[model samples]
Target chain A: AQSVTQPDIHITVSEGASLELRCNYSYGATPYLFWYVQSPGQGLQLLLKYFSGDTLVQGIKGFEAEFKRSQSSFNLRKPSVHWSDAAEYFCAVALYGGATNKLIFGTGTLLAVQP
Target chain B: EPEVTQTPSHQVTQMGQEVILRCVPISNHLYFYWYRQILGQKVEFLVSFYNNEISEKSEIFDDQFSVERPDGSNFTLKIRSTKLEDSAMYFCASRAKNIQYFGAGTRLSVL
Candidate 1:
């Protein structure tokens, strides 16, 4: 079975500060990776995803993540974050094909942006 | 902008009672899924549906829980006898290929 681990439980950053949320996964083969953000009462919105090719994948909201195969990591990063960026972020993985293509999400990282 | 939509923002049901959560996925999406999240826990996968058949399910999706794509537009999750532990936010997700989209979610409370 595959699992995703987001080491940071909660992160607080001042507005305009650079942000990075670490994520690590344990899977046998290279899996489909994704980053999603959820507002306090809203649904999970996809920021970006990595299937193949580029190790550095760009997403919406000026956010990006790099997939390092050797390290089994897909970390989400933003050059500068705004107060509106404060929310819960999740890292997920899904299988390739026939084998139950459901996403397995990590515990999540709660981001708190201060003024 | 098309997105998944779930009904009843919040539902309060008694234990041993039956509850059905409804969802309307993105019109073009062919794959559908149901996931649950305990208040402070991770989002857990319950079942995945595609082409009118089940692709996969998790251990937490026991006999009490079932999913249906009854019509062309709707996919539903039915819990035969709800339990107290089942109180959580249930999210409906739809996917086409790798990108999976989610709805706001229905907070189910079993008392």
Candidate 2:
């Protein structure tokens, strides 16, 4: 079965420091990958997505993710973390040729930014 | 920027009571979906709706659950008999293409 895995359950980063959240996926074919961030009392916001082109995809809030096919990974990274960036991040995958494009999401990584 | 909207940010219900979660998807979107996340678990897909019919559903969406696009603007998920294990955050999403937009979920607490 296709699934997504986010290894880091919780991560703490100092404000202004760089950050990286790891993600791995298992699927038969090349699946569409995405990263979403959810703040308390808010909906999941699209951070970035990896489709057919460009290994590195840049998204809102200065977030970027790199999709590595050989490693079966799509990791999200940010050069500088902000206090407002403290939130839960989820990595999701959708099959390429599936009839109904239902998303398979990984257990999220909760990031806490320290001032 | 269009978005999907869900109602009743939080709901509390007794076991065996019926509960309906509501959503209003982006007007032009063609696909709709329901997903749930347990307190500390990954978000799981419950069902997908398109063209007023269910395109797909997961095992978690058993006979107790049903979905409807009542009036072209609103989509609803009804649980015939709520169970204690049904407590979770339910999310509504809509898609026009490859990207799916999510709404602020409704946290259901079944006591």
Candidate 3:
């Protein structure tokens, strides 16, 4: 079965600093990868996704992720972190060509921004 | 931008009682999905519905759980007998193509 792993349980970063949230997936073949963010008392919002094109995919709110096939990683990156960026980040994956492409999500990394 | 909407932001139900969570997916979306997250756990897939029928479901969706699309817009999940362990944040999502939009989730608390 396909599974996603977010090794970091919590990460605290100072405001205006760069940030990277690590994600790794285990699957038989290349899968569609996605990054989502959830604010407190809010739903999950799509950050970015990697289907088949470029390795680097840009998303809303100054977020981006790179899909590295060799490492089975699709790590999210932000050049500068802001207070509003603090949230729980999840990495999810789904198989290709399925009638019902259910997402398999990682445990998520809680991001805290310190001013 | 279109979005999914779930009703009754929070639901408090007694154990062994029945509870129904409702959702209204995007009007143009063809695929509807239900997912849940335990307090500190990862978001887990519960079931997926398309063409007015369930196309896939996870092991967590057992005899006590059921889904229905009673009308063109309303999609609902019914728990026959709620258990304390069923307390979680249930999210409803709809997919137009590949990307899925999630609702603000309904927090179900079984006591």
In model 2, the runs with Cα more than 4 Å from the true position are none
List per-model TM-scores for chain B: 0.98, 0.98, 0.98
Q: How close is candidate 3 to the true structure, as a TM-score?
A: 0.99
Task: Give each model a TM-score.
Answer: 0.98, 0.98, 0.99
Q: Residue by residue across B6-76, what tens digits does model 1's lDDT show?
A: 99889999999999999999999898999999999999999998888888888999999999998899999
RMSD of 3: 0.7
**lDDT per residue (tens digit) for residues A1-115 in model 2:** 9989999999999999999999999998889999999999999999999988899999999999999999999999999999999999999999745557999999999999999
Higher-ranked by TM-score: 1 or 3:
3
**Which 10-residue window of candidate 2 chain A scores lowest in summed lDDT?**
A93-102
Q: What share of the true interface contacts does candidate 3 keep?
A: 0.90
lDDT of model 2 at residue B6? Answer: 99
Categorize the docking of model 2. high
Clashing residue pairs in candidate 3 (N, C-alpha, C atoms within 3 angstroms): none
> lDDT, candidate 3, residue B52?
86
TM-score between model 2 and native: 0.98
